[model samples]
Structures are given as structure tokens and as C-alpha cells.
Target: MPNQNDSDSNIHALLIGIDNYSSTSLFKSLEGAVRDINLVEAFLKNTLKLPTERIRRLIAPNREDTVLLVARSAHEPEPTYENIVKAFTELTEAAQPGEQIYIHYSGHGGRATTIYSDLKGEGQSDEGIVPMDIGQPDGRYLRDVELATLLKRMTDKGLVVTVILDSCHSGGTTRGDYAIRSSGETDTAIRPRESLVGSREELINNWRSLTEGIHRTAWIPVSRDYVVLAACRPTESAYEYSVNGKERHGALTYWMLDTLNTLPGTLTYKALHDRVGAKIQSKFPSQLPMLLGEGDRAIFGTNRISTHYTVTVLQVNASQQRVKLNAGLANGLDSGTRFAIFPFNTADFANKQKQVAIVEVTDIEASSATARVLAEVEGGIGVKGQIEPGAPALLLAAPTDLVRRVRFHDQKQLGEAENELPTQALVDQQKEALDAVRQALAGNGWVMEVQPGEEGHYQVALGKNGEYEICIGMPIKNLNPPLMFRDAAAPREVVQRLVHLTKYQSVQELDNPASELMDALEFILLDQNKQPFPNPSNITLKHGTKAYLRVKNTASQALNVAVLDLEPTWQISQIPLRGNNAAFYELAPQETADIPLRFTAPEGAAYQQAKEMLKLFATRGAADFRWLRLPPLDHVIEKQHEATRGIQSAFGKLLEAVGTEPNAAPVMTRAAVYEPDPNADWVTKQIQVTIVPESLLPD
Candidate 1:
């Protein structure tokens, strides 16, 4: 053995061996050379604390840095010992001081000395890896002494070198049936070798022929500092089983990788063997992890591992318009980093909430850069976008009418006081528009009422006498965040102006000699509330009675005369009023339309006849089915026609004529009053009346 040297500060390791020969090349096997090399590299980097950036990997002819000599030539023809030596020499020259270098090889092995046979000729074989340099002169195989010398030289320099050999060597040696063919072959199939070892003699002969005293080191104890783990004993052959899954390596590699980070500490050469042995034993119960080494040395380093964390959303402070969250250490998360917020579907917020788009952080004073962000969700029609922290983002709604209160979904009224409430201006505009609609309808005899809805919304209801139900509904507030509105109403005087039934009735006798007869005419004025406006002044009118009718237009807009469709016979002269166009003018509040009426009494008993005729036509329950509803008639005869047909055939015709005529004769008998129904419609009411002797008038 060579002596140790001082230049040993730069410790290095060389792990070399062939996984197979031409007969059993390692390149194509389950635990192939490539797999073992890759495994060892990973073991050092991940399990041994070696930084991946600092490691250099070399493989055969593809990478010229390392010699490909150890690889099978049948599989990889470019590899040769000379090239390998050249590369190693260069590596030695470039190596840095105090640097620990590791070199690994996992392939075929050979022993003793023999002449090498190639396609060309024979040559000296120096423990040469088979199939790389074929056909040479001399055909001399390397002796055990020569190989030992090389190992001694490396050890003497204080470099840690690990060499692993997994191949058949002798007869008595335990050998596996595993075999591999070169990749170059068209049919590179794996099969069992025919050769078998039975006794120690055959084993001894095989060992002696490879190298003199090659098994010498196998008998000595190993050192912890330098190590070598072989696949088999000196007299045994390394074997491999099929790796069943998607694994690239055999059992040994699999166990190492799986347990590397899981293991308690660095696997010193000896400890590695024990651990691997335990693993293998637990699995196979027959095989053990093999070990070969010298000197004691610690193997790997501690503190080499990997880690994982979660992101969660905290409080979403809408008033401030900011979200808060807790964040631990993480990657790719910063204040300005963009993030998308989606509703949590797992629990309380289970897909019920809407998801917002991506947003960037404007400020991050309280939370970490990676902290979860909260987004403000807006409601109402066409609402979108996120709200900032502590911002006013609620949708505000107000009632459209003063009579009703605004209520939330929970039925809570929205108000600050008994009458006044907090609301947006938009609600007020909505109310104004709504009131305009109500007034317009009211002018045409439609009774309307408006009520405030939740969130400044408004509800409109039409009375039984009104024209339509669903009024024009619009949001007072815009369909954006901070939605709000207020209430509005129609002009007060417009609501107040009406037909004064009480005043009309109170002066009945002043305008008519027959006060009791005129007193029977009931009158009512319906207000905006649809409630009856009490007419305290009961009034009535008789034939030839003169009464002045007054009408007032108290609206903010122009009032159409068509609204007051009055009965004829009451001659009316419209008087001009201030603050309004007498023709088509906008009438200001409290303006009155003075209307005068003229009536003329009939000759003889004409007044009595007109009164009876008017009464007959005016009763809801028919006083005379033979008569039509008509305005009170005048003194002048419209035009009389002689009896074209006798009263019998013309009776029905006369009743029908009464309906068509503005002024017709009164029903003088009970038979005339209660005429037989022609259409037989039950909706039509008929009543019986008898003309008494008192009803007749003297000429």
C-alpha cells in the first residue's frame, strides 16, 4: 500500500465499477450503470447536503469530461481506458484545495489477469472494463497487484474513494442468473447466464485468474472515512431483480431514495450498509446490504430539507373598504402582487357569494404581503367592482310616498326619526317622477297611492277605481355602490282641488223652490287617498232651477278640460281665471274656473213632468225601464211628433226612445215604470212605479 501524503487536504472520492459484462452488460439491466450513477449523484446532493448547483455530472462518450472506459463497448463503442485516464488526469490538475469530490460508477467488473481479445488482436488487459477496448496484441489482463496500487495511490492522498463491483468472479461464488445484452444489438434481451458456480475450487480458480490476491482487502476490517459498497461478496455475483413499477433503478436505489430525507442522520459508509441491510432484510429477509471501506469518517450533513403553508382571508372591513388577512412566510406574494378573490365554497360562504376579478393591493400596512385579501361585494341592479376598506358601500333605498315607510328585507323600516330618514337624493327624484305619474293618472280619474320600499325603493298601488296597477318603477339610486334615493309627492293644491258637494247642497233652497226634492241628490268628492271627501252641504236642484258651478285647477301642470265631462242641459259659460291660459294654459294653484248655468221652466205642468222625467232617468235602480238616463230638461218643446203607431205597438219603441232622448216624458203608471226585460240580463235593474192621481197636472 502507498503511504499517506500532506496534499490530502483536498479529499476526493472515486466510486467505480461495471454493472455487467458483454455476457451480462450493466447498461441494459434493471440496476443498470446509468441508474446507479444517477442514484449516487442524487444521494450526495439531496441526502448528503451537496448543493445541486455545485455538482458536475459526467456520463460516457456523450460527456467527454469523464472517461467512458468502464462502460460496455458493445453498448457504447466510444468509451476507452485511454480517454478515461486523460480525463481523470485533467480533473486532478483542476481540482481545488479543501474540496471534496465524489466520483461514482456502477457497471461490470473483472478480476485477475488475462489476455484481452478484440476484433483486431490481443493486448495487455489492466483489470480493464470489458467490451470497451476490443482486439489488441499481448492480450494481457491487469493483475490484482496493479489495481491495488492504483487504489493505494488514491488512499495515500487522503482522498475518499468508493468502488463498487457487482459481477461474477469465481466458481464457489454465489451467482445470480441475471444477464444483459448490449444496447447495440437488435435483440438486446435480458436473460439468465448458463454458467454456474458449485464449489470453492471453481471460485478460487476464477479469482486467481483475474488478479493475484485480489480478495486480500475483503479479509480486512474497513475504515469509516473511506468506503466501498459492493453488490456482492468477492466470491459472489451481483444480481438484480425487475423493478416492477415506473422505477428507473433496482431495489437498492429505490430504498436509498425513499429513505434519504427520512433517515435520521448522514449515512456513514458502515451505517449506510446497516440501514440498507435493514431495509433489504425487511423486504427480502435473505439478502443484506454489503459494505467495504477503510478509516473512520462522518458521511452526510444535517439541515437539508424542504417545506409547505396556506392562504386564508380574514375580516372584510367594508366601511374602511379594505380586507385583512394573516400570512406566514411564502413565495411570490407581495404588496403589489396581483390576486383573484373567489368565494369559499366549503362552508358558510358556500358558492353563495359572487367571485370578483383579480385586484392589486393599494396598501398593506397591517397585513403581510402574502396575507389573504378581502373584497367588497356590492348589491342592487347591475352592481359590480370591489369596494375599498372603510368605504360607504351599502345600497341605500328610500320610500317613494310619504304615507308609507321604507323597509329592509327583514321588514325593518329605514328611518332616523319618526318622520325624517336618512336617504339619498336620487330617491327624492324618483319620488318626484312617481308623483308626476300619479297626478297624471288622477287627472283621468285614477286613484293612486305610493309607498317606500326597502333600500330607498318605492311601491305604487292603484285604488280599485284607478286605471293601472304597475306604475313606472325605477331605481332612485344608480346601479352602483353607495346606492340611495329619497321620496317625492304631487303638488299639494292639485291634491286639494275638487268638486265642493257640501257647498252645492248647502245652497239648494236658495237656487230652487223645491228644496226637499233637490236635497235628495247625494254628492261625494274622492281624494288622492281614494277616501270619500265628506260633502257637508247637502244640495239638490229642481227643473228650471239656476245654479252656478265652480271648478278649480290646482295642479303644477296644465289641466285638460276633458277631465270634467259634465252632463248637458246645464248651460255653462267658462270664466277666465288668473294664472292660467283660459284656452290651453298651465293652471297655477288655487285658480278657479267660474262656470255659469241658465235654466228655463216649462209652460203649464212642464216643470212637474221634467222633474218626474229626471228622477226616472237618474235612479240607479230603474224608476222607469221605459226611460233613459238624461239631464234635466227645459221649458221649450224640442219637437213633438204625432203618434205614428198606436200606443200598443209603440210602447217598447217609446221606452227605447226614452233611453236615446235627452228629454223624454215621465213614467205615469206602474206598468210604464216596470217594463218587461227584453234582453233578460240580470245586471239590468227594473222597478215598478204607479202614477197617482196627485201626479197629474191641470192645464
Candidate 2:
């Protein structure tokens, strides 16, 4: 029970070593031997940051590192199982802060059936860890399922527990023994993978009982914290030494400890596996070490001891939307550490292909977090003659089956294959880069020009500096907001922005907020015509302007509105939503309400200082539902065509004023002529239009 908070010197260690039934039924071999246990005990005491003085031993007589359980003979009458259980229980109860309990069992392991007391005749038998007793005809070995449940419960209290299983039993649902083919003879038994790892009911039953008394316990969530190291796959046997005068320890266990002891500094879980697995294979040539746990979680791109990084995409030119990402070093990052940017098409990588476009860094953007630099290319006949940016040119993928050499800036080969070139991968790399460029173009203030080669492929160039160009030949996407003439367009944009958040899987949590705000804003921007204001439905607020919003909750839930990142110039007060059909208060069930917001815009000089804060809030509020794509926008006349009573009554006044100037906002002053019911009184009032205009005209 080592507490995570304890200093390195305060930790404790508990080691167990058992050896009985040497030949057949008993725990046998070097796993339970004095030599193996002693080596493991010394490694724990020295390598681990545990207090040496508190190390408890239960094996050898008078030794503090051993925990020896009373051995039972296979021939003894009523062989005892309580000794091992009692020993484990005592060790578990004695756990305290800075104490780690290590239970290592190395002995003969075999399949054993669990026999319940009720299954036997009257006054027959009870449940226990049975030993192989040659004297008793009715003795059994141990099953992993039974042992796993007991061990899992004993270490339930957030303990820094480590269970090392060095036995030869199939860890999962596989029978280890199978016949091999002799010459051309067919194999006799099914392989381990073809057999049941464990009964689903048995696993469920054990965990259910383990968590029965615990409060608020459920199935374990897959986490990086927990660690498990198995000697081999559940179906394989752990190999022992066969050479004379060689190390007597099991091949897997010996190498596991040797690698840990000799390796300097801390080894990551994956690294440790590779080292230990390779070392054992070199010596025995067939053993592998299974190391599992959360790897060393070093914070990247930071100095503080925290594990989070801020991923920022900075716009070099806001109007042109020429953006470059600046990924800052997170807290706990090793400073000045070299980092390689390995960009691979993730989709292509899944198919076991290395579609990598290496971007070598020639220079670091001193004011930015620019890492990899792309080299430039020019002066080639039959090749596109665009003068691209120098040093930061992309690592171009050449279409060829055999890649002879990839020469970088200094004629150094980035890569060279002996015979075959990666041509398919080159095609995939180009596709991925093109896809990313297309996604970025869907935003405002950006355009792409792809000039196809006369032979094949195309030359790509992005609009640089402040130039804004639109090419009609390119595929048309929803780059501009729809229904820009009415205030209702804000709510429509909000809904569209909601769709944008789903583009990145990392930001799924914002979906609920996006949906809620979209519904709220739709109710306030509509009038008697059920159509948005023709002139300015969606207003683009300047960098300094302040505006108010009104949201009518047309649903049953009490909607909550939270505004983030409005600073000294832009701020919000407590705006509630409840009323039958009010404009700026709480909108009750089936009611509408408005929110009055007032704030000053930052002065010219102070604008850039608050840009990041403003941008982050606006982006979060928009929540990924972008206007690039919409469900569909229909005119109010379409609803009237559907025979809806409300739409017909609302739009009847506009029809009457059709003969008048078409530019005028059609008035609905005639109450009886336009109202769906003469007695039904529901008048809409306008919130103040102080900062934003009364109506916005389309560009």
C-alpha cells in the first residue's frame, strides 16, 4: 500500500517466495528456488525507491526478505489451504503509506477445477487453494481466475501494487499443451488462440464479488495508470535454463530483472519491453518480456512539471487567413530537447504504409513555434516554375517504385532504398496535404489555386500577402454565411458553427452548448413575416464594436447562457430567461425572451492586445458548427406552401404590401388582417439597436 505522495525514502517492500511439490503437483523449478527469489529481493531493495530497513522477507529462515508459507505434502491428510490465504491477508492488512507489496510466485502451475462445498456430499469439503498431494487421490492445483479475484480485492485501496506472475500457466483461456506436426503429419490439438481464454461467467462472477461490498464501484475504465507484466502470452509456458552451469533463473524473469537493473535512468514501458525482449532472445532466442503500465509521461514543449500543451494555430495575416501553427512547450517539458516532426497520412498509415512527407527545419521562427523547415526547389525544365518560399519547401514525394536517394538541403540523403521505391506512398502524401489545404480554404478570406500539369498532377499555390482572389473554376463550398440580411442569421451561423466542432474528434464536449444556443437565438430574430431582415440578417461585428443578443427559449428546459472572453470593452450582466412571451427576461415554457448586452469596443491601439482572448471565446462559442455547410435554408413562402397556419398568417401582410416599394420593410400594423386569431394578442418588441445597426445590407 505505497501512497503516491510518499517521498522516495519512505516506501516499503514485501517479497514472497514459495517452493513445494518439486516434481509434479507442487510449485516447482527456479521460480520458487532460493537463488531466483534472492536475486529478485535484492533488485527490489536496491533499484526501487523503497526503505531498505522496512523490507519484509518470508522465505528463508531469519531472513527479512522472505515470506515462507507452511508447506503441505501431497500425501498429507486434509492438506491445508489457509496458510497461503492467511499470509496474503496479513500482508494486505499491514499495508500503509509508502509501502509496496510485491507477491512473486515461481512454482509448478497447472489447470485446477473449482469445487464448491455444496457440490460435494453432506459434510464433504470446503473451498481452498489445493496442493498436489501424491498421497491423496482427490487433490487439485490452482486456477488463475480464483487467484485473480482474491488478489484484485486485496489490493483495491489505490495501492501502488505490482503482481509478478512467473509461472507457466496460460494467462488467458488457452491450453498450453498441443501436438506439433512431425514431418508432414497433421497437428492433433487446437492451438491456444482457438481455445477459450476464460469463461465470461467466471470473469464476471469474480469481479462482481470483488466489487460487491465496495461503494460506488463499477467496471474498471481503461486507463494508462494500471500496469501488468506477464512472462509470456497466457497460452505459452515460461522457459527455464537447459545449459549446464548457465544461470538457473527462468529466461523471461532473469532478463526482466537484468534489463531494469543495468539500464540507466528511467526506461519507458515500450522501451523497456524492446530492450528486455531483445536481450532475452539473444541469450535464449525464444523468450519475451511483457511490461505493461503507464509509460514515462514527460510533458512535451514545456518546463514546468505538468502534462498538457497548448496547440495554437496563429494567423500570419488575419484578412488573408494565412495561418501557421505555434505549438508551445507544455509544462514539465525537457527544455531544449530535440523534437522531430514526423507527418504521416494517418489514414494511409493504418494500411501499414509509411506515407511520410518529411519537413526538415532549416530555421526556427524566433517569434513563433516553427519546428520543421521545408526546403525550396527551383530551376527545372518541364517542372512548374513557381518561386516558392526558400528552406521551408515540402519534402516532395516522387512517384516511383524504387526510391534511389532523397537528397535534402546539403545533398544529404534523407532516405535511400536498396531496390524498390515507395511510389504508392508518395501519391497518398500528396492527397493528404491537398485535403488539409481544401479544409483551410473553406474559411473566410482564403482562396486556393491548383494549376494542373500538362502531363499529370498539379502545381499548388496559396494566396499570399493581402490578396483576396476567388476562382470560379474551383469547387464551390459554403465559404460565406447564408441569410446575411436578418438578425436571425446570427442564430443560423451559431448552428452552422456547431457542425464545425465535429470536424475534430478532440472537441466533442462542445456539441451540447452549440445545440442549446442555436435554438435560443432562432426565436428572437424573426418577425411577423417569419423571415429574417433582408438587409442585414447576419452582422459581422468589427474588432471594437459591442452588441446585444436576445434568445427566446421555445423549449421546456430552463436555458442557461454564458458569455466568455468579453474583457474591459465587452462585458455581460446577469441575463435570465423566464417569461410567457417577453423579449429580455427568462422565457417560460412555450415562451420567447431577449438578452440585452452592452459593452464598449477596445480603442484602435488596444485592439491587438485582446485579440487572442476574444478569438478563443468566439471560437468556443461558435463550437465547430461552421457555415461552410448547412442543413438547408428555406424561404418563408415555402412554409406557407406547406399549409402551416402560422406561416400563412405571418406572411399575408407582406403580400398586401407587394404593390408598394419592394425595398421597404413590410409593416404589419393591421392587427386583424395579419393576426392568426383576432383575440390572440402576442406583440414582438425590438431590443435596443445602439451599437449594431437597425438592418445590415449585403455586400
> Scored by CA lDDT, what does every candidate get?
0.30, 0.30
What TM-score would candidate 1 get against the native?
0.29
How well is each residue in 140-240 modelled by candidate 2, as lDDT tens digits? 33334445554554456544555555544432221222110001111122212110223545645764553232211011211222334445432344555
Which whole-number lDDT from 0 to 100 does residue 265 have in model 1?
36
Could you report the Cα RMSD, in angstroms, for every candidate shown? 47.4, 26.6
lDDT of 2 at 111: 34
- When summed lDDT is taken over every stretch of 10 residues in candidate 1, the lowest stretch is 649-658
All candidates: TM-score: 0.29, 0.36
Lowest lDDT sum, 10 consecutive residues, model 2, at: 649-658
Query: Which candidate should be chosen as best, given TM-score against the real structure?
Result: 2
lDDT of candidate 1 over 1-699, digit per residue (tens):
011132123434443333322333323322345555666665665434455444333333323213333342443223244434443444444445334445544444444222212211343222323323322321122223333434443444554555544332322221243332122211112222111211334433433443331123231223233354544333333344445543234345555455544544333333344334334333332232355433122343211121001122333444424443222111112354334344321112223244333334444321122223334323322223443211111101111121122111112133554223244432234344335544543421112342443332233322122211221143111111211112133232222211111111111111222222222222222232434334313223333333333344433332222011112222111111111111111222454433232233333331333211111011111111111111222222321111111011100100000111114476476554554332121111111111112325233
